[model samples]
Target: MKVLLYAEATRLISKSGIGTAYRHQIEALSRVGVDFTQDWEDVYDIAHVNTVGPGAKNVVRHCKNKGIPVIWHVHTTPEDIKNSFVFSNFYAKLSRRSLTRKYAQADHLIFPTQYTESVIRRHGVKVPGTVISNGVDTQIFRQNLCKAREFRERFSLNGPIVLGVGFPFKRKGIQDFVEVASKMKDVTFIWFGAKILALLPKDIRRILRDPPQNMIFPGFIPQEELIGAYSAADIFFFPSYEENEGIVVLEALSCECPVVVRDIPVYKGWLENGVNCLKGRSNDEFEQIIRTLLKDRDLSEKIATNGRMVALERDLSVIGDSLLKTYEAVLGRCRS
Candidate 1:
């Protein structure tokens, strides 16, 4: 069946996790031979909108009026948006009310994680919902020895590397990353993502300007380069306070890199503290976990191997099959 897939501010979201998710979903759908269009005006069986913006709301309204089933992919909520960037907390307050109204227009709602589904439900979203991971392309993100070597030589990196991928935002635990870096001078910490320095809060800007010597901000690298970074790194450390689903974690896991993430509820079933990956609830715990991983090769390898298995389970091919089922289920419900 043909579908209309729309995401508002696609250009602006290209550097964000939401953009990566949208691209992965599109790729998965195509792999399953699902006919879809990005054009809002295109005639289709389903309208899958990925944002809660005015344009997306309008599309949902139009689809509802036309007797078309609409799938609203919930990518962001007010809680996750708070403290993300300058003045985001203020916008988050307004976003909560706006999301409630927009979500009501959907025939079905899709959440990347069960935690997100609960969050939306708590916000009074009464629509039927399901959880589906925004899966990873394992082929593109897998380990490559040659690319890893190239990345090390290009950056003149030495010692065990610790990598974090995402925009430099406060809610992403940028401050905690920097603090951890200061205590570990021997380790090279690289944060691979884009950030608008001017738009960041003054305190955050100050820290970014005079970051720890061990910390390197390689703003927005290409996919090939990113895969190399993931492969080359000894540990992937993500301390982000919020996430619908940490897609980059899956990418790192796909590359067979052991990860240490903040002990957040979003990773409840997806990540285990000592099974697939380590979890740290504080700066001290994070530092200790990283050190333990660096010193113990066996433990690191074991976790990395398990993590890769988890990634494989959520690979795009599998996700494609699940998505098709969800779509077909939605269509069946519409018919009934």
Candidate 2:
């Protein structure tokens, strides 16, 4: 079938989750020889608009006018706005509410994870959407990465490394990470994303105690460098208070890195608790959980194997098929 993907927000700074997701999905479809177009030159049977904000709304409306089935990929909600330091509160709220309406009216509403689906159902909208989890490039984050050890040494680490990515601040649960890291003095913690740096001024940064001696601050690195970083990380410690569904988690899991995620339905169910990840509710919980994984090499390796297997099963190739199925189903529904 013919499809036109309007990835309007792909221009954001590198490592931006939404932009990365859009770009990767577009590439995934192309790799598999899906007959899709980015521009509007050819008439498309379906128009998948990635994102929920104003930009996507316009594209959805245009497709609706042309009688093409529109797929609205709702990645975030109003709660995300409250929790996001990367995007200003005013903009997120405005975008969330409007996007909700646009999504509710679209031919199909698709979410990256079941957690997002569950929350939106409570908002009193009867939208027909499926929980299609986002996928990762398995080749880059796989257990077979040749540079794993070399990359670790390059990052100046021979010890267990705790990697934290995405925006910083209360929303991302970095504050909790700081509090937790201060107690467990063994593993090294590192952060990325320029937006995280921009969140805290020099004065605010000074107050936070310097992390463990094992810790290192290797400023923001480009997306291309993330494979090396993932290869080196001993654990992907994500304390995000609200992640629509962390793409990084998939990336890390693909690299066979065990994850310690907060008590969120998406990660909790999507990933087998204690099998692929350690699920927790608070800073103390996460700290203890990390401690368990760190001490148990057998457990860590087992979980890592499970994580890579999960990534292989849920690779972009698989996720793309689900997306197309939704598109075809929606198209048939529209035709009838």
What is candidate 2's lDDT per residue for 288-316, written digit by digit as tens? Answer: 88888888999999988888887888788
TM-score, every prediction: 0.98, 0.89
Question: Each candidate: how many clashes?
Answer: 0, 2
**Number of clashes found in candidate 1:** 0
Which one is best on TM-score?
Answer: 1
Off by over 4 Å in 2: 86-96, 144-146, 196-213
* lDDT per residue as tens, model 1, 235-283: 9999999988989899999999999999999999889989999999999
